[model samples]
Target: MKLTQIATATALFFTAQLAFADNPETQTQPAPAVEFLLPSVEVVASPPSTPLFSITDPKAPRQPLPASDGADYLKTVPGFAAIRSGGTNGDPVLRGMSGSRLSLVANGAPIEGACPARMDAPSSYIAPESYDKVVVVKGPETVLYGPGASAGTVLFERNTPRFTEAGVRASGSLVGGQFGRNDQNVDIAAGTPDVYARVTANKAHEGDYRDGNGNTVPSAWNKWNTDVALGVTPDADTKLELTAGTGDGNARYAGRGMDGVRFRRDSVGLHFEKQNIGKVLRDIDARVFYNEADHRMDNYTLRETPPGSMPMAADVRRRTVGGRIAATFDLSERVEWVAGADWQVNWLASRSVMGIQNLSDMPWTPSATLSNYGVFSELTWFASDVQQVIAGLRFDRAAATDDRQSISGMMSSMPNPTFDEQRTRVLPSGFVRYEQNLRALPLTWYAGIGHTERFPDYWELFSPNSGPAGSVNAFAGIQPEKTTQLDIGAHYRGGAVDAWVSAYAGYVNDFILFTYNTSMGKATSQATNVNAEIFGGEFGATWKPDGHWRVGVSSAYAWGRNADSGAPLPQIPPLVTRFTVDYTLGAWSAGALWRVVSSQHRYALNQGNVVGYDFGPSGGFGVVSLHAQYDINKRTQLTVGVDNLLNKAYSEHLNLAGNAGFGFPANTPVMEPGRTAWARLSFRM
Candidate 1:
């Protein structure tokens, strides 16, 4: 569908909803009072709400001046790290795993990026502040959202608006910080019992940030998004909604040869939900969505062209359409079953121009087309008041077709052996878990085992220049990745203490690995398969000794090795920990956060994923930050904070090397931002 058509339809729907609210029979109600205040800043995310699952409010103010994108916000959660490229749009890594292993879903749809180098990752398109809820399911423990979530699954969702009478509700925020940073957000909803309309929009911008050494990092970005939703509530048990949104952004990357001049996103979706259908069928939910990502990068748009290098630009786009249907059944008094089927189809195309030609004017070339169909069922049995069993099974058929007439080689275009060829795989995934709640103590323990088979993603199949030995290319050589893992965890909640710990160990067969090599002054990457072993864990605790005081601590660690080569895995994050203390009194509160990260000594040189590589050993560092909040009124609040208080210059272990075009030495990791201050004003009515 066209963007204009979607926008026009949304406008009409919103007007209709408002007109319905003007009915003489409709009873107008006063807005409710705000009863609770959100935390000033989230230094460390609260412990998981359940076994391997966490739910967070995405609109809450957070440390480090909030986030510019989804990945930046996930870093506050333990076991989550980001591969930073610049001021924004960092790629998210969970348990040292990247790529398709982590399923990212936004509003019941999967959005894929078109950049072969992954400059615009899936998370880049997600505006976290625009969503009402963020749910994280760690590990391959569930089969509800999608397939191949061996590392984890993250969902960004917007709750359907419901109203008892004719009324309006709104919330918003404004932010300002050093380095020319600023942000604005607004959310508004209006409705009666029969219909509702909601709108959310945000804009964020920043200039180049300085490091501890007082050097500019060549990082800057600007982004904006607007979304609209109209819902019809025929009864208390049913809801039907339609959503539309569009967003665009630009960024200057310090770690790549080109800067992103455009990141255009357009989306449309329809959702249906029903509950309490019958004695056996509890509820049914279904949705269909369309998402498109049109991206462009150039060497001259955001910065000056390198000396003696001609200006160059490339444009690429991916169009995805998907639908899913799921139903929940009360099989017995104690057993509940959920079954679903989903299917998706995506097409990618690109065009490029050199010198003085406009890239957009060039005719597009078809690159690849991919599709998947999956069916899944999950069962939960409540054996007793204190015991439960959960199991799930899923099967997927995935296929990819290469549409390229020829592949690019080191020196020139070459005949492609896999041109116009199709490859397919049938994969299966399943998991089982047992849970026990101690009757005498406020604690719960659980254990589970899961196995998954993942088809090679676009980056692994087409981005590499070469493939395994004796293979034509990555598309023809890379094999499916299979992982089997055991997970165990415990959660304890009592008087003043709340704590949780989770751990996982897994063996991966045919794990995909990338190796970077420089020959004849040209850098090329090869995709290969290897056996790998991985293990990791995260622990956290919070102590509320009294109503006025709160303290928290959390840490995460991950390790991996190539079983075939006996070498450490590339791009694994080092151990990291956080300590937080807060004091609240009346309408004012203050807090402090200290973060420590260990040095990384084990790594495979020049090897990693499509986005980053292991350059060398990295040094450890620590930093501190402080924040305060004041309630301006019942409906307004103000928050202020300073990050990197000590001006510590450090780089994360999972990092991309600084681009030489930005005046940084080859193989040098990009440095993080220095000491900075920021403030945010939020209000609701």
Candidate 2:
């Protein structure tokens, strides 16, 4: 088919689907009771409100992992995917959306890494095991955080301490598992009724991981971190906090060409929250923070470079700093409001020696750097006890300024030059929603529409050597992406028969894309501002008609398409369903999870049926799990779980490229592990 015809067809398909979101009938079905089972070690057994697709909540006591970097702990959350380069630092993705789309916050502050290729993704600097909780809010449902979360927002927070009377409290855990996974974590707090001090530390390491085929993948890593904070609570309504932290780690990769030989990070922050100022204003939660990262790559970190593979390779580095402030107000008993602003700036530098057989010295590429800043706010109004309306708006301006006398790796015609070019962008976003609670039917219904704008991130700009004929490097060349979407859903609970369902559809403009050319042996990608459509829903049910037995089943499906390209976007997973059943008898609960994923058939990059490396159309795989928990007294518990019990060999649609260095046989491919088991012991005093 002609390109125009293909484009026309794609546009028409999306137009019809996106328009369906407003029908309201889409959410008429009853909602099933769907409770998420968080990670065994740090899990919050149950809560008054069920937080879907979330693995952690702030109510639980903080328990740092015995040993780990941030990426290792993210795996505990379902629907989260990561690109593996090494053990300590993995690129994090949620619902297939990656890069700058997802916002990462630590202790309610923002910090980004300095690597051009994302050698130090923000999450990599975090010690997940060291924090108290990890909260993930999916989709663009709320706007209270910073900006550009078209995918979602992830908040890794440290729990706050409150004491009515003078007392000291502490919680700790120890874990020893397969693959040399030994972790020890401790959280301690002590002070007078009005003051408290807290501290956390962690470390971890692993050898190369063997895939299902027993072929080792370059995943070896080593890392450690420490955090100290002081809190003063004059009263329950007001509090002040000051925090400082430092962490560093290194990883070896089999998939990427380079390894992270050095991962050094430093950060400091201050936050204050005041509540109940008057009848009209509720409180102000504000903060200021600074974070920096330095990364190094060399041949000695992973393995000796092969011939013709840029040998004698060594040394590269990057750095970044960010800050923000936010406030909340209670206009009245039924209405609340919020506003905030944030900014980020980063710099890059690299030096390497390359030659034949590690013999000669090649001059290093000149150091390069860029800077960006944005200003962004959000508000909500409650209509009645059973109804609410929420609206939010934000405007952001980002600019990239570079200072250099000469440009490296440019065309010959572009002779010597010394000047500065700066590009500034303006973006505005807004959303509105209405919710209703029908007490007569014991059900709650909500519907909303939102639009968001995302600025181009460093990876999209600095990583690419060239942009389209008329554009600059991705940073200056790509336009800001905007998304207008509608979300509608309902929750219902009817004794013995509970169910739930939520659906959403979106229209996207200026959707970024990446294309790879195997024949040319190079990756060709760009940001194409095109219309797009996305829709999905999750449903589940639970039946416990009588005591001692229970049956439950749940399913989720999401789909996305680029209307202008007539091609399926990368990393969109196929339909998936999960079934669980369990029994409870005399102090013990046992359950099983049976999951099935349909085969993915739509693809574009590699061909009509593409299926490999940063591409799509992956075959399907099934997995099963068995779990049990024992309540050993009110303060202590023991839980054991076995994953992939059948030892099935499988992989997710989104996967990391395996490095050739770490022992992955050239002709053979690597797959995730077949099976794994874990046990958790918890103590609180």
Candidate 3:
């Protein structure tokens, strides 16, 4: 800590930050800099030396959005699907796998909410416009992110910035749409030779939407978020950055039993990047993050209740703290190695009361804590110009501990006196892949095999009433789920357009299933050690048929079956297809899109549908949309689009049913959002 030593460390640190700047400039400032640490590098992006897709490419037309939760964004890519939960926050599924199978990482941090009902899911906290990149890896392709993700891993990242010359940059947008909806967004940044700062904010609001049937459904929502970032960039490949943000919003659900009264989030994180770390290590990254969510739900909001009826209410909050440090080593031109360790801890609690008077008598339970730690390593080697190899391994330890105990309410009637011990387990996962390039055929072929063993998450444990048979609930009973799978795909790109197709098959030991009964208002779900199999694939094709016209088509399908029970898995998306055609001239481009989905008549027996339980096998429907965009210049663009152009009446297979107290009758069904029109204007400065 001497002045000379401090000076040396500061020089090395600032030099790293300099790398992230788009411009090479250094300024002298006295503001104190904060540092953060992150777990490890996810090696699944591109096995060896290949490049992955970038979210910022201006020429790449954005993928259209569907009536969905954020999971639709994930499904746009190959090897992705979701278990629909009405309209938003759909449970993301990977290669026919769901629940805790997929990993969600925000700003290099891992988080899981505490509600057994999953009302406060981790993805609910993410905003599409807030991040710079979204990467999805199918199947246990990588192990550096978390312990169990038997399905895959998703990474949401905001880029680190650097400064060259003294200047300021800004971008803003305003969007107005039909169905009582509108939005405004702004992104501004300023920097000098040595420092850079960025701020982004956005607000969106919408009222109740009607389905294709023209029937109004209670689907109103309003949300806003702001982010501030600061960085010091000294070189082209290094950066020291800090970020903080706070967001709050409310979303009304027509399919759920309760509406999200409050969705508040606070996040803080720090990141550091270093290139040329040593003789062998090429890059070093460190980051630390803290994120929290406070969510509330009630029956009276967004719906009509019976006269003199007591309201049903619930409130829950969760917080996660995590950090990691990782290094990438380049042993030689043909071989690369990555090593790192990560740890995350989450704490959450909830309070609920059912009475004619909001709150009559009920004690709020103490907080529940779940902790986890893991270390992982991965290596990549280029065997030849036509071949490459990748291998990875990871080990994890996780546990849930209760500080307070009581037989609250409904559980008091049952004899529950054996729950004082801690729950813990060790899990290991690994994967290997082989890729070959066929130059003559203009094709790339890749095949990979992976295995994952994930410990039971909080939702799979304490939320259920039965476990592997001996214990009273999954909390003390269920064992880790083990999964092994093979992934193979091919990509062809030798013409005006490019195309890729990927597929996967897997076997899961101890698949987790949830069973619900409406009469008793009880759900019996458990992680049974039964065998299961799943498979699916997606294909994308884009063609520049003519100079002024372009055609694009994408399709996906998935299937899953419980080998032991001989039944289809619940909540799986059915066969779906999409087509689009666009024509452009001078400064304007017009496009029309069509989507068709087949009915999901095949599902598990007595399984829960998108609603609470087995309530629907919605009829198939078709939707069409039209979009037109005008480009004024390189820095400004305007886009206008009309969704559900036909205004057809239809409900999604995964829709939540209508509430009896709400305007909807007990026999009525939930409705989808009605036809809407939207216009967007963007300006860059």
Candidate 4:
């Protein structure tokens, strides 16, 4: 059933029953307590858009079996893709944009990966099911988050539950699948109105998976996490929360020369909120956080070192500290405003050991330090019931310092020109949007324009061996990226049908791009600046034919061009479409999803982002999945699904080529799994 239909029926049903009891003489006895189960949320590879933004429950069951990280889950959304490396932890890309162009925040903090090769992208540290909500804002539609969000902003948050009385609340799920895949998650809370405490934990493990050809690829992983939150509510309008978390994991990579021996995380945070302060001053929100990641990579940790290759190990670590303060104001009946400021600082260090040496005995070396401070304001104006406007402005100061003393190459060593040098930039960003609702028709249309200036990130400035010509290095040579984009969208809602479409076009000046070259069996990376253009659109429609049946379809397409070289941008995904059919009856619900991806021939050889480069061209493929949900009782539910039911062999366009150690030719893309069955059981109290 459509979401609207279900809501309408529920409202009408309660209204009718209440009207009958208006007269005391006709009042009936109270009905027995009963639970009304809502239809289960079906997992679709490509779901329809939700208004100007999208909010999804991270714990909900999703297709492609189970997502291993935040990136895997985001792929189910249109206009989003993952640069695959192995079974999990693919780097996320949106609208042909990747890297730091996308702002990723968890619990109001940003935790950047430490790998120079991007083996552990930021998303790799995120376990989707651990968070309560996943929120996404596409395009440069808002400037309240921070700078450098030309592609978009993603947030993973956990809501602090407030209690009115003493009680216990809990929710959990267990999952199992083929190839020794299994996971467990649990969340529990108990307390009184004055104070409360909550705890969440999860564990997941999977063995090497076989491709459609029954070939085992070097992909396997195991991880676990635990977090706790304590909250104090002194009054009805105030709340203070303290939170801490820790986690660790290890994974075997299929596209790299080494395996991740450890991915350890430590975090602590404090948040405060106060509401209903006065008429003009609405509320205040403030938060502070600290996060650290310690990662290690070694060729012999998870697998034997290849012949003629020396045993080597590298350890890298990153520490980040940040805080945000915001206030909401009601200037007038038709005007509302939000103003905020955020600041963050990060420290990075690394050390390596070779030839059967003790890694811990080596001292860590400090490499880079980065810091940024931003201030922003957003205002909303309601001209009328059918018209609205929103505008936001932001400014940021970014700074970075290099700490290397010397550089070493295969041939010679040179003084590090940028050593002890600091680079800084002042950036400004803003966006304005106008929305109008048709009086006669159930429709809304909106248009927006945004401009953003992005400073070079850690990878762009420090990872590459060389910078643009005629400069000391990337730190001093690369310029900040500037983007100007226009976005337009429309939404329509009628009796039994709802549809929406959104499109974006943008031009980028001084875009940061990376190129790879090989010499004497060693690869060297170079960073450069270029001009580029990008455009994309996503559309979807859903129709409810009857109370128990619904059908929907969604499609997404993206295109890009490198203006300087007159070549197609690398790592652009092909056009894709999804079809879904759903049925609901009482306590049982079923669904079927079919996904199709078109061929991509655009190629910019040896050119791409840090995660991967384009592999000439990839062919189209189709896959179908079936899922069913059953509500065993008010507090218990079970979901079962089969993905790639036909056992078809396929590889995504944005993929990393398999490494030679994995028994595959160098530069050969890895194949996805085939015909996997999975089941999940969830309970709440």
RMSD of each: 5.6, 13.3, 9.8, 7.1
Q: Per-residue lDDT for 81-169 in model 3, tens only?
A: 55444446655665556667888887788755555667657676766555656766767888778789887777777674565667666
Better of 2 and 3 by TM-score: 3
Candidate 1 lDDT over 531-613, as tens digits, reads 99999999999999999999999999999999999999998999999999999998899999999999999999999999999
TM-score rank order: 1, 4, 3, 2
Off by over 4 Å in 3: 1-69, 78-87, 354-364, 407-418, 521-529, 608-616, 663-669
Of the candidates numbered 1 and 4, which has the greater TM-score value?
1
Provide the lowest-lDDT 10-residue window in model 4. 1-10
Q: Highest TM-score, which number?
A: 1
Compute each candidate's TM-score over C-alphas: 0.95, 0.83, 0.87, 0.93
Candidate 4 per-residue lDDT, tens place, 302-410, comes to 9888898899999999999999999999999999999999999999999988788889899998889999999999999999999999999999999999987777666
How far off is residue 403 in model 4, in Å?
1.2
lDDT of each model, Cα atoms only? 0.90, 0.62, 0.68, 0.84
Best by lDDT: 1
lDDT, model 1:
0.90
Model 1 poorest ten-residue lDDT run: 1-10
How would the candidate models be sorted by lDDT, starting from the highest?
A: 1, 4, 3, 2
lDDT of 3 at 473: 60
RMSD of 4: 7.1
